[model samples]
Target: MLKVQEIRELIKLIDQSSIDEFTYESDGTTVSMKKSNTAPQVVREAVINTPVQTTDTKLVKPEPVIEARKEVDMEKENQKTEQENTSISSYDHEIVSPMVGTFYSSPTPESDPFVSIGSNVQKDTIVCIVEAMKLFNEIEAEVSGEIVEILVDNGELVEYGQPLFRVKTK
Candidate 1:
């Protein structure tokens, strides 16, 4: 039987890839998963075949608990962004993420961050790292500027083209 964590990992991998369906069967147990582009949902069905009886279980990805937590987190983030936008100037340049990945402020957790608010940066300065598919990509400042805001928290999951930092250009 596959663990819940393992199933969740498989769901994430499939969602990121081009595949839309997957199945696994072994030892009288079968696991099947399907993804629909039109809907943001994943359906998983597990079946246990026994000599005398059969058992079936249906599990959906983004369970209610997870969905509710995500909603709350998004609400808080939206509020924070609204306050931040009030202080952001029209001339500020946004440094955006190049790919979908986990954001890291520092090369290593124990070390200081590559850049912080008020830090002066050159166009080529390393500002942070984005880890995607086991690859650690160094993100550059891309503009000569002073860091005005860090849009994402450390270790947060960021989407492609998401703004990572707000810079006041020189």
Candidate 2:
């Protein structure tokens, strides 16, 4: 469980820092924070090339200086995201365990496993359970995919970022 004061301090840092994202891991807990982007003021300018007429003739030309402004393309960003998703599905992707703990196949003993090979899953689906410091933490899927393989057995010790399962992204 997170202490109230610690949580409050985290919120204060978020309010103070210019960073839009932060991630921290300690004592079997992982916390990720993100903030949205703000629009920037755009300025544009022009450029002119000056040529020397002759070596003997010194000519003074007023050149038009244009400031170049970068435009953000939404379509390109979307296409990149689509390409990333396509690549992720081409091979089995690792479902990383977030903490060091005793991994459980189910929330409790004598229950059917939370997931198995070839299980289809959404982002929020609980793939396994990890017990740390007597606290049960549900390990969730970050990607929507089908389980391709199980890397760890039930009751196995799992380290952070260890491959708990290999998934085939949809």
Candidate 3:
């Protein structure tokens, strides 16, 4: 069995190296680690030999041995499909502004915006401000959910089909 430090070292090694597979075996114990950038990406895996308990020692414990980490060729196709699905779904479901303008994350020059990352909002909640022809337009949320990610920066100029906020489904 490898020590915790050795395992951590192995992880660092794997990260630094471009090689995908590594296996080490000694005596009756066999351990293996692998990395592959295959479709649906199976990135890393580490295996360790389990140790039996002894009455004389309580210092070391065995780690959960990783068996295998390999990319499934079949899932590669599914990954592309999923990407397409997400793109289409995201396109069909966005909070479009009624007019073109400079987008703002806050309600006023000094006031903080109505929403931020991980903020829970309703369908009609105002999320941002759009200044069109010197008029501030409150852009409301069309979907009710938690803000997953912010796509736009503060005081960014927004155009049609430009995403400003990404929301997680309720």
Which candidate ranks first by TM-score, i.e. highest? 1
Those runs of model 2 whose alpha carbons end farther than 4 Å from true positions after fitting are 1-90
Candidate 1 lDDT, tens digit per residue, 1-170? 67767866876687678887887766544555666634334333434332332255544333121111111233576788998778675337999999999999999999999999999999999999999999999999989989988889999999999999999899
lDDT of 2 by residue, 17-42 (tens): 78777666555444555554532212
Cand. 3 Cα-lDDT: 0.69
Against the hidden true structure, what lDDT does model 1 obtain?
Answer: 0.77
- State the lDDT of candidate 3 residue by residue for 26-63, as single tens digits: 65455566655543222233434566677887645666
* Clashing pairs for predicted structure model 1, backbone only: none
TM-scores vs. true structure, each candidate: 0.52, 0.47, 0.45
Candidate-wise lDDT, in order = 0.77, 0.72, 0.69
Note each model's CA RMSD in angstroms: 12.5, 19.4, 13.7
Winner on lDDT (1 vs 3)? 1
For residue 44, model 3's alpha carbon misses the true position, in angstroms, by 42
